[model samples]
Structures are given as structure tokens and as C-alpha cells.
Target: MPFDDFAHNPRTLLHIAGALRNRGVSPLELFRRVGVPPSALLDANGWVPRQLCFALSEEAGIVSGDRFLISKIGASFELVDFGPWGRTIAGARSVGEACAVAANNVELLHQGSALRFFTFARHAELRFEYHGRLGASPHQHLLGSMVFLRKIALLAKVPEAVSVRLSIPYSHGAECLEETCGPRLEFGCDYDSIVIDRSILDASIGDVGPNPIEVAETAEATGALLKRLLPYGRANLETVAAHLRVSARTVQRRLRDWGFSFEEILDDVRRTEATRHVISGENSAIEIAFLLGYSDPAHFTRAFRRWTGMPPRDYARAFRSNYS
Candidate 1:
């Protein structure tokens, strides 16, 4: 799948482009290989596939220790299509209803993840769990979720009583952290979560329609379709087409209509897995390269440099710097 289909915003691509440039790779070459128009990066509001995003990361050699290329990419951009959902959600009758709408419609924004919403007497909590390897970093999902929550509050025009709880320790410094999540932000938590005051649930959403249940159903259907199309470990055009009882040609044509090729999709899946391996620190660069099907360490190095600007060693060093 094209990364354009999975990304919430195009600016993430720009960040990757910049990182690639830093590593001595030509951004235009990377964009061409990934099938992204060079100009699309400037339009921050545009969307791309999450898989493409991961492929770009792999191409950039971002897989590994401390630099958090994914978080930087995600954080650098604002959510596209967020405004429409925000408008619809803000009109909801209560915080509960708004949370429900957000929970329902999130798949419209990104499908490789799952969300759970819980309503308690005192607070409403939203938890995001990613079902696949994210292109940038594991924590990218958490940061992206936080950004989504922040956008939701902005769209709802609610008082900013919402706060985020994160599993990673704060590395961006106290001031930057406070600015990002509000003074209420808490890090080094067991999991990532967003909490909203229960009183917000009582607020009336005058413009919301009465058919949230129907909308929720439609959202679910959309989510299912997105999940079917996304690149995953089990995904191969032939395998998918076989299961769907369609010819591989038909599958290729269908994905072509969406501007992606099967090779691109498989490359994305491999790239995402490669990043995960790098972050876990369980494999050498050469091993990871081979695991992803590269013929040798040199080819992996060349490919990694193309994907991320830094060499694998330097990328890993930067990534670990934040953790240390």
C-alpha cells in the first residue's frame, strides 16, 4: 500500500525527506521510489499510506536506537481530515458522545491501530493500541494518539482539561513536554492513555445529529476495508487475491487504481519490521539487512542510507541518546 493512504498528514514525509537528505540520499529519488509526488511534502494537510511512511523510514535507515524519526515525522505535522471529524464530533451532545464519535471515527484517520474508550464516573479514558509495526518508532503511535486527542479537544472547543499518560520517559525536556501535553502531562506510565474530566460529558453538543449509532456502523465498515488493504506480515498480493478469490492481476489493478504496487506494499511491511528489530537492539545491522532480504551488509547500508540520512551506526547512536 502507498504510505500516503496511512499517514494522517504529509509533513511527516517532509521530515523523512529532510532526514534522508542529512544522510546524503536524494529526497527526490526516495520520493520517486515510494511513488510520492515531490510537491506533496510541502502540503502538510495531505495524507499518505502508513505503509509508505514505514517504507520511507526504512529507506532512510531510521531503524534503530534513539533518534525517533517517526515521532519527529508525526509531531511535525497536523492531522489531515481531522477538521471534518472534529466538526462532527464537536457537535456531539456530551463528552461521552464526543468520545464515542472519536472512538468510532478514528479508523477513518488511520486503520492499523485499535482504540478503546471507557467512561467512568469521574473521567473518560481513551487508549490506543497499534496492531502493526509503525514506520518510525513504537512510541510514534502514542505520540500520534496524543496529537489526535489534542486535535479532538480543539475541534470540540472544549476547555483543555485533557491530559496524556505515556510509557516513555520525557526526553524532550520539561518545558517542551509541558508545552506539548499541557502542564497536566505525565510520562513513564505503564501505557499511553488520555484522560478527560467527567464533567465534560455533561456538555450539550447542539449541532450533532441523532444518528451516532448509524455513523458508528459506517465507521466500522470503513475500518474493516482499510484493515484489509493495509500491508501486514500476512499480506502478499497473490495470497490476498487467492483468499478473496480474485486473480492476482485484478488485485494489482485495484491497488494501481489506488496508486500502489504489490512490491511497494511488501517492501513497506519489511521496512516496518526492520525498524522494530533495530529498536529492540537484538540484531546487528547486517543481520537486520539480511532478514529484510537484502543480499549483503553493503546493500543494506546503501539502502539504509537511502531510507534515513544517517548511517545505521549513527542512527542507532542518536536513538539511544534520547533513552540514555
Candidate 2:
């Protein structure tokens, strides 16, 4: 399949790229192997193709010579590692509130994944629905959920021993899962969930100091950006302002305050999208030009050169040579 079918947060891939880069791996080669364009990392609100996520995970395992690399990487993720979404969770009043926020907004982290919260008299469970691609391992999903829940507990100052337990769908030797997470690993379970003591639910968040106002401001800025890119191909000022239910002057003023302009945002998105399409080794410059709203091939060629300091053909060649 081509790289355009499924989309996900590009942050994970950026993290993987950084890790691999530190280990003397060529980032371009990694992107080539995964059929992702390197430019996808620049736009924080942008999504990369999901196939790239799977390929990067598989390649990370192969390169590191560690079959458990997925879990290891996921376990090492910090609360701040999740960007704005993590801050939103951290800004909540309590652990339970954070869990609810995460549950409600998991799509901001990963598009196809779901986090469900269930509360009982004694405990609460955070269940994860990975919705991973066929034949892809679910270890990353499991460990990520565990680490996220553990961080929540830690942030809330809950005792480690009795506060949280983990249940996973697959049995990866009780000892291994126990070591990756903590002691309480229930393998061979129907769902991947983290069990937490309900008593800790109301505990005030202690160490992870967060500013709710910052979170809201960030969200507002992000929403404006998303609004500009809605339908992607149509990125005019009037349309975006209407979509945001505001006047064009207001939208312009707000984005200007944030050091943004509609033309700049549209051009950035087109550049990113154009790079992805070109690197797939499927579309020609002419096809991609039209696909990205450029009616004139010469105009697109100039814009791409301005964005990348090279012609699209040359850029595509460099990307292809990485894998070849």
C-alpha cells in the first residue's frame, strides 16, 4: 500500500528518528524504509501515514537488535513527551480527571486508538483499544498504556506497590512484562488495561505542576491552525474564518499575534503534503502539483524549491537513494 491511507501523530516517528539518529542511523534511510517523508516532523499538528509508524517500529527493533524495543521505548516515554495533549492531562485536578481527559482526547495522540475508563467500587481501569495494523505487534500499545497510567499514578503521588496493576492481552512471560512495567502484570487477559485504586482517584495532583491557562491557550492556537487546514486543499482566509465562526479580520489578527499568516500556513501544509506524495515513489511532479492545489507545474516547482532548496525531482532522487 501507498503511504497515504492511514494517518497518525508524527511525534512518535520524530522520537524514533531522533533515537535512531543518535545511534548512527541515517534518518533519511529510516524514512525511506518506512515510506515517510522527513518533512512530516515539522508540523506538530500534522499526521503521518500509519504504515510509516509500523515500519519504523519494526525497523527500530531490527536496528537495535532488541525484540522488546517497542515496550522499552514506550515505557521510557515521559508525561511531557506527549506534547500539548500530555499537558492537558497534567493540568487536570486529579488522577481520575486526568484519566478522563486522556480517555476523551486519545485521538489527539493517536488517531485510531481509544482509551476507555471504567470505575468500580474498589478500583478503576484504563482500557486501551490499539486498533493496530494487521501483523503488527501490540507490545508498543500495551507498554505505552502501562507507562501512561504509571505516570498518572506517580504524578498523583500514589504509592507504587498497591496503587496500580496491569492486565495485557498477550502473555510475554510473566517475568518480562513484570520487569518492563512493575510487579502486577496479568497476562493472557481479554483487554489491555491498567487497574488503579479508586482511593487514589481523588488525590490531588502533586508533582506534575501544570497550568490550565497555558493548555487552553495552546488548544486555541491549535484549533485555529486545524481550522485553516480543514479540508486541507481549501485553505483561504475567508473559508477558514467562516469555519471558525469569526470574521476574516479577527482570524488574521489572531494568527498574526501568533506569528502566522494564512498563506504561510497553506504553503507549509502543501509543502509537507507534496513531500509525502513525492517520496512515496508513486506520484509524478505533475500529479503532485495538482494534488496539492497547484495548477501550474512551474509554479509548484518554484514553491517546492523555495521550501526545500532543491527541485522536487532532486529531492525525490535523494529519498530514493537512501533505500536503494
Candidate 3:
């Protein structure tokens, strides 16, 4: 797949980066190894190669004993693109109807993640399984998956989830995990899963007051916007403007109205992805630097230090220590 086609959402990348940082991998080094320029981390509209993304995950697995990339990039869930889909679910007459919509049409929004709903008379369960081989840094994927599911449930207004499960092993932040999972999370399970009361699935969504046609149009517009901004991992303002057949000034103004600059969004993407690679401990810092397009390891090192306060080696060591 083209690097830019991977749907460059910075928030997703940020979650990945934060996971790696927590595990002791320098974000800059990870970016460098992945062939992403350090500057890209700051370019809100920048994109990175999909191969590099996979590589980061693979390397993390080797170094960190976790395969987060598979769950993160391989899995399909997106909040930005979910505007219409969420509205559709929100407009559903009942919980089962909403879930049916999610089951049948999630592909209309995202293709990477799978949603399975098991409805029994008394209880209902929703299991989101990420398809594909596990990446080196799966913890980032796990965390992101959890967060995404929680958000979905919250948006759907499920009264409460009975439990949440993760396939990856436990980490240091139990308290934080509980806070994120809402006091009913069960970690270290066979699969990443969530259990909800069946009654919630029957509850009416009420009116969200959005037109389905307008929502669909908005989704299409957003997809087109992402395509232009992320074009195959080459995210320069000029390039983006050219792709959109618009002037650079117009693009800048549009982004400004969104309360972000292209540069800021791109940087966020790079840093976020770098963190995921670093934490997974699957790739060498040198390799990651090269993958990210940094010719000089020293430059990568300096940047990594700035991003995570430690060199790549130290970061990897710390991550292994905590998890192993």
C-alpha cells in the first residue's frame, strides 16, 4: 500500500509514539529508522511510507516482546472518519440496530479493524479482532484498540461495559489502565475483547439530528481531504496543493480554519508513529533511522534524545526491563 494511503491520522500515531516512549524507545530514533524525516514529525499534513510503518512494528516485536503494529495499523478503527458512521449508529432505533449497522457498514468507514457482535438473550459481547501478523510493538496497538473501543461504546452510550480484555501482557500503569477502561477492565486475556450488557444493545439511540445524506457527503469529503494531505507518504504543502489542484494559500487557509497547520499535523503523525516503533523494540535504532529517511545516525540520535530524553539503546533497554 502507498504510505500516504494508510490514512495518516496523527492521534493514532501519537498513541503509538506514547506507547514506545513509555517502554523506553527514543521517538526520534524510531522515526529515523523508519525513513521518516524528523521534520515530518512536526508537519501535521505529512505522510510516511507504509513499509516503514510495518517495519517499525516488526522491529518492536523483536526488541520489546510485543507485536503492537499488527493490532494498531492492521486493525481498522478511525474517529475522524467515524463522524457519519457514528451518526448512523446514533440514529439507530435500538442497540441491536446500531450494532447491525456497525457490523454491515464499518467497512464504509475503515477497513483495517473487524467488529464481531455476539448477541445472546441475556448478554451481548463485542469483540474487535485485528487481522494480520503481529507487529514488533503490539502494545501500542493494544492500547489504541482499547481506547478506540471505549470511545465507540461511550459514543453509543452503553450504560456500562462489564469487562475489557487485552491480548498483550500487563504493563506498569495499572491505575491509568483502570481509569481508561472505566473500572471494569480485565487484562492478559486470550484475545482483546469487551463485554457489555445485552439490554444496552436494545436501547434506543434517539435522534442525533444529522442528515444521513449530509453525513455521507461529509465522510466522502473527509476521505478526500485525507487522501490529498497524506498522498503516498509524501506530504509537502506544495505536493498536497498540487494533488488537490488548489493553491498553497488556499490549502493553508483551509487548514487554518481547522485550527491546525499542515506542519503541526505532520509532526504529530511522525512523532506518534515513532513512539509506537520505539516501544515495540522490534527494530534497531540505526535501521529505524534509515527507514525514516535520516541518513545520519547522529542526527537521529540527537532528535530521539530530544523527543524522549534518552538514546535509542537506553530506551529499548528500559522497555525490555519493564516488560520482561
Best by TM-score: 2
lDDT of each: 0.56, 0.64, 0.54
For candidate 2, lDDT tens digit of each residue in 1-324?
Answer: 332444677555435554555566665565655666554554567886665576667777678665656666666566665677777887889888988988897788676677898899898877876564634554554464565566665665655623334444454454665555667666666766777888888887855643332322332454445434533456577766676677878766654433334455556567677778878968888887777766688988999998778999899999889979
User: lDDT: which candidate is best?
Assistant: 2
Model 3: residue 110 alpha-carbon error in angstroms: 4.8
Question: CA RMSD for every model?
Answer: 14.1, 9.7, 12.1
- The residue-level lDDT of candidate 3 at 51 comes to 40
Stretches of model 3 off by over 4 angstroms after superposition: 1-84, 108-112, 156-162, 206-324
Model 3 — TM-score against the truth?
Answer: 0.48
* Model 3 per-residue lDDT tens digits across residues 1-324: 322444332223433443454566655566566765434423334444434555555565445555443344323344433454555666667766766676666554333456777787786666776455433344554565565665555545654645677776676755456555667777778777667677566566554433433222322233344434442445567766676676778766555433345665455454545566788778777766665546676876887887678987887789789889
Q: Give TM-scores for every candidate, taking all chains together and pairing residue i with residue i.
A: 0.45, 0.61, 0.48
Indicate the residue-level lDDT of 204 in model 3.
Answer: 62
lDDT over C-alpha atoms for residue 208 of model 2: 68
What is the Cα-based TM-score of model 1? 0.45
